[model samples]
Target chain A: MTYCLGIVNCFGIVIAADSRTNAGVDYISAYKKLFDFSVPGERVLLICSSGNLSMTQGVITELRRDIQNHEEVNLHNLSSMYDIARYIGHKSRQIQDRDRQWLERDNIDFQCNFLLGGQVKGEEPQLYLIYPQGNFIQATKETPFLQIGETKYGKPILDRTITYDTPLEAVAKCALLSIDSTMKSNISVGPPINLVMYKADSLVVRHTLELRLGDPYLAKMRKLWEDFVRQAFEAMPNIEWQRETEASVEDILID
Target chain B: MTYCLGIVNCFGIVIAADSRTNAGVDYISAYKKLFDFSVPGERVLLICSSGNLSMTQGVITELRRDIQNHEEVNLHNLSSMYDIARYIGHKSRQIQDRDRQWLERDNIDFQCNFLLGGQVKGEEPQLYLIYPQGNFIQATKETPFLQIGETKYGKPILDRTITYDTPLEAVAKCALLSIDSTMKSNISVGPPINLVMYKADSLVVRHTLELRLGDPYLAKMRKLWEDFVRQAFEAMPNIEWQRETEASVEDILID
Candidate 1:
């Protein structure tokens, strides 16, 4: 399992991915899932991949090849963020095609998904959740973020707190905190985390942090969250029952 | 969809369930998902269910019939909470037997699950997570809470805070808050929650709250959680980049 979350707002973009992967309880590994393409002073785009290792690795390799060859569709040369998403989706589909037989015969799905986002020189920053089917959708104010992989576990926080007005740093924190939640619930998604924050129009990979275990800040945040939760519990309203509707064991029994 | 969560501790037990059902995004309705069989001064048992409304409702209806018709086993006469869990599991399998054909033909799953707990006379408090196969597992200090149905969204806080020493009111508050997270994220669970909190040895349902929409305390807690989130974000550690390697993007491309 993996957690890849990105929030793009008026300020910029925040993207994070967890490194844990597992093939059941016995086999676990750490593989960085966030890849950034930043031509310093030129462009900074982020790609977070999830799903089957083989399929996503294949897609990433293809994406890298395009960069090495300076292909017209490479991340550095894309006309818009949306175009980048389409390209990613296309690459994912291509990988699936190569494994089509195995996918059907062995019930193996190369279920690869990628989230691509960033800004070009002239347009506003954008984010897209590129699907395995070679289609994608951009983030809008109504839904200002995208999450992939083991997404359901961390979605509630994003749903409640993410918006276009959210600051870039706050978005990054939210992404990591969301990942933390998943880590505790699912062993397959333990940290070290890859977090990238891009400032709008910066044309540089701004603040990128690698949070490994024992990172003091992450530790403190976890503790504070625990403390806050305790406080939240104390603040809740007390139960006000109209009356105790008591029923006897005999009264609840049948004839 | 539905969300039901319970916390068992030395202080007692807290169980909360949302009453929402949906056959898709458009066809949505509300139905009670919480059932209780309490013998006021002697024993108390609460069952919170989530999944196919038909399956869950069928289980509850069957239990009611068992009580009125003096079926082979009934919750009211159960000597232990563990026995109650087995009884519910048996009734669950029975319902599945009768409805399995309709579900299989339509390609729909009768995925009824339950979170049942309470005190039965002499035993200390207990909690169980009942699966569809008529098997259940009890909660322990290592994992003091159990949730069913749209549960992931509401699980992070429970993972961090719940334990055997947790107070009855605190656990109750956590249950409601967890339910709130689910209600906000999924449309399948919403509004007017049904809550029950049991005090050990009292064997009586002492605390119960039906949280309707627009409840002041609910609104306040939601806001406080949001504010804390915002605050927590600002406190995240700053990213530090050391003597940067001439760059890694090139290596990624070349490789």
Candidate 2:
């Protein structure tokens, strides 16, 4: 299992992913799931993957191979972020199709999902969640984030905090907190977490951070967030119940 | 869909459930999902249901019928909370079995999961999550809560806040926040929320609250929680990045 998320706002886009991969509990391994393709001044594309390891690796390898071989439509040559997303989805489907039959025969899943986020030289930074079936959806202003794999645990925070007007730094912090919450509840997702903040139309990755267990800053953030959460919870007003004689009234009536 | 949770602590137990049911987006309804069976000074049992509405209703109806007819092993006649849990599980399985064939023919699911929590005379307060397979597991000291249906969105808070020693009032508030978070992330799980707090050794419910969308207290709590969360995030230390030239030291090392 994996947890990868991408947030797009007016200022920029932030993409994050966990690095743990497991064929089984006993076969756990750490693999980098976040990959970046940059042309320095022209375009920059980031891809975060989750699902079958072989399929994701294969898709990434093929994507790199396509760039080297200068395929008709490679990430570097794409005109828009949407086209890059479509290309990644197409390549992902191609890789899965190559293995689907043998994998199905062995009762293994050949599905992989990807979060593609980046900016082309002339276009706005965009984020897309490409499904296992090679279809995709872009984030909108009202919903400025997309996530795949073990997503729910980290979602409430994003739903509450993220907006198109949110600053890039704050969005990055929220992404880390989101992954931290997911890691706390789910064992399959773990450190080191990969994070990147791309400024809108910068055409280059400016800030990136990888947080592993015991990393000082990660440790400080975790402790601080947990403490604040507990304190906040402790400070919330307790439900004031009605008097026993008046309990028959509506249940939410307070005092 | 539904969201129901039960928390057991040294002080007592708290059970909460949202009252939303949907056959489809077009066919949505509200039905009470929390029910209690109390014999005054003897025992108090609270049942929270999630999953197929038919199966849960059928199981509840059967349990009521058994009690009314004075069956040998009705809820009031059970020897322990575990027995009552097992009885509920048995009835759940019976109802599913009765509808399995027909439901399967129509490609419909005849499954329901339940949370049973209460205390019988001479027994300590307990909470059990009964699966659709008619098997159940009780909450433990390390993990003092059990949740069913649309559970993930609400789980991180419980993972962070709940414990066997948590005060009942705090646990109740935590349960409400859990449901509130779930409702924020999942449209299928909504209000009016039903909450009941049972004090240990009392064998009777002491406090219960039902909160709806426009309920003043609920609104206030929601606003307060959201505000506190944002404030907490703002108060957290930001990631201090290393200089680009020194980035090779380590992914998380600060300058």
Candidate 3:
């Protein structure tokens, strides 16, 4: 299991991912799940992946091979962010298909998903969630985020806080907090966390941070968020349990 | 799809559930998911269910039938809360087995889960989560809550706020807020919400509240939580994005 998310706001986009990967309880290991493909002045592409590790590695290997071989349709040759999403999705599906038969025979899964976020030199910064089936969906102004795995525990915070007009710094903080919530509740998702913040028109990645388990700043932020949440919960108004009539209250009570 | 939870604290136990049931998006309807069986001075049993509606209804019907027919192992005749949990789990599995073949032939799921909490005359109050396989686990002092169906979106709050010594009223509020979070993130779980609070050794449920979609207290609490969360997010320290060494930051940057 993994937790990775991408947020798109007015200032730019932020992509964050957890580094824990496990084949089973005894086979746990750390693997970097975030990859960067940036041409300093021309384009910037960030890929955050989750799902089957083998399939993700296969897709990444093919992507790099294409770039080194200068294939007709490589990441560096892509004209738009959407094209890059399609290309990644295509590669993911191809890799999964190669192992689908044998993996399924052994009752193993061969699917993987990716969050593609970045800017092509002439295009605006964008974010896309590419599915294992080779289909993809782009983020919209109303829903300015896309998540890949172990999403639900961290989603309520994002649903309430993120928007297209949110500032870049605030968006980065929310992304880290979202991953933090997931890490606390789920053991499959652990640190070090890889985070990247890209300013819209700058064709270079800036503000990249890798937070390991006991990093001081990460620890401080986690404590602060936990304390704030407790305070918030303690402050909510209590339910008026005595105001309702007896008959209505006992409607479902069997005696 | 449903979201129901049972919380046991020092003062008592609080049980809450959403009322939405659907065969599919086109066949949505409302059905109460919480049931109570209290014999004023003798015993008080609460059952909150999630999963296949028909199976839960069947199990409930069997329980009532046993009581009405004066069966040797009915709810009223049970010796302890643990026995009651075992009875409910047995009935649930029996019902599922009855429909298993036919349901599977049509690709339908006949599984269901339950949360059983109550106090019998001479026994201490308890909470149990009964799985589809007819096995159950009781909640402990360290973990005082049990949840079933659509649980992830609402779990973080409970993980952060609930404790064995939490006041009954505060526990009730936390349970409501947990369900509220689930409803906000999942359409499959919705109002009107059912809540019941039982004081330890009382052997009866004293406070029950049904909150409709726009109940004033519910509305106020939701707004306050949302506002407080936003305020908390805004108060967090911003990440110092530029202080790190450029070389370390750019190590993963592909060009």
Candidate 4:
């Protein structure tokens, strides 16, 4: 399993991914899941992928190949973030189609998903969640983030904290914390986290980080978050027990 | 979907459940999921259930009927908490077996799970998670909690705060927050939360709560938790970006 997410706010976009990949317990290994396909002054493209490793790696290779070959419709040639999302989704479908039957024979899941977030020179910075079925949905002001894989454990914080107007740096912090929460709760999602922070109109990737296992900063942040959570929990008001005649204790009941 | 959990620490055991059930989007309804089956002074048995409504309901009915009919092996007659867990599991298996074929014909899921927590007079306070296959695992001092149904979203907090030495009230608070997190992240798990707190030697449950939708305390706690979380996020140290000369931005990359 994997955990990857992208956040787009008024100031810019932040994308992050965990590095753990596993076909089974014994096959667990660390593999970078985030890729940069930026063209310096012309465009900024970031992708985070999850699911069948072979299929995702295949899609990424094809995407880079299209760019290196100067294909008519490649990530560098796409005019809009929407088209890039569709193109990635299309490549994903083709890869899955080629492997689905053999995988189905052994009852394996052959699907993968991607989070596409970046700016296309003349267009606004946008984020899209490309589905395994070759369809995609773009983030809007009301919903300014997209996540792929192992998403739920880290969602409550994002749901409560992120918004379109959130500052770029704060958004990046939230993204790291989100991945941190996931890594803490699930063994499948381990460290060597890759994070990128893009300034909305710069059209050039500036800040990127890779926090490997046992990194001092990661440990410090985890410790601080845990302390804050414990403090917060301690501050919650205790349950107000109803002051009534204790209900008959013999009333063993069912719903 | 449902979210039910049981946490047992040295102080006692805290059990909680959310009351949302749905067959389809149009059929969502509220129904209690927590039950009290304690026979004062002899034993304390609390059960929280999740899964196919019909199957769980059937299992509950059978358990109740066995007790009322003065069967040879009813819950009150069981000498140990382990036997009670097995009895409940047996009852669950029976119910599923009876309904499996009919449900499977239409591709419906007939499985359900239960979290049983409490103690018999001569034994220690314990908690067990009964699987759909009717096997159960007891919570140990090292891992003091068990959860079922829509569980992931609510798990991180429990992982961070729960332990054998935590206070009973604090454990109860953590259980509520866990369920609250799940409700916030999933529409399938919703309001009218039920909670019960059992002291180790006192077999009868002295404290219980039923927080209906829009309850003042629920709203207050949610607001406070959100505030604290935001504060915690703000307190988190900003990522320390590597100082390497910015990598060549033209390197459109793969892998």
Q: Is the docking of candidate 2 incorrect, acceptable, medium or high quality?
A: acceptable
TM-score of 4: 0.95
Tens digits of per-residue lDDT, candidate 2, B1-255, equal 899999998999999999999988888889999998877567889999999998899999999999999988899887998888888988998999998999999999888999999998899999999999999999989899999999999999899888888888888888998999999999988899999988888765768888887788888888988888888778878777442333332342221
RMSD from true fold, candidate 2: 4.7
DockQ of each: 0.37, 0.38, 0.42, 0.44
Chain B only, TM-score of each candidate? 0.91, 0.94, 0.93, 0.94
The pairs that clash in candidate 1 are none
Cα lDDT listed for each candidate: 0.81, 0.88, 0.88, 0.89
Model 4 misplaced regions, further than 4 Å: A243-255, B243-255
What does candidate 1's lDDT look like per residue over A204-241, in tens digits? 67577888977887788788777776775676656455
User: Model 4: per-residue lDDT, tens digit, B1-255?
Assistant: 999999998988999999999988778999899999988778899999999999999989899999999999998899999999999999999999998999999999999999999999878899999999999999999999999999999998898889899888888888888998899889999989999988887777788999999998889988998898778767777778864345564453321
Worst 10 residues of 4 chain B by lDDT: B246-255
What proportion of the real contacts between chains A and B does each prediction keep? 0.45, 0.42, 0.40, 0.50
Candidate 3, residue A116: Cα displacement in angstroms equals: 0.2
Give one digit per residue, the lDDT tens place, for model 2 in A1-255: 899999999999999999999887878889999999977567778999999999999999999998999988888888988888888888988899988999999999789999999888778888999999999999999899999999999999998899999888889999998998999998999999999988786666768888878788777887887787777768888797542333332342232
Residue A124's C-alpha lDDT in candidate 2?
A: 87
Q: What TM-score does chain A of each model score against the native chain A?
A: 0.92, 0.93, 0.93, 0.93
The candidate with the higher TM-score, 3 or 4, is 4
Number of the top lDDT candidate: 4
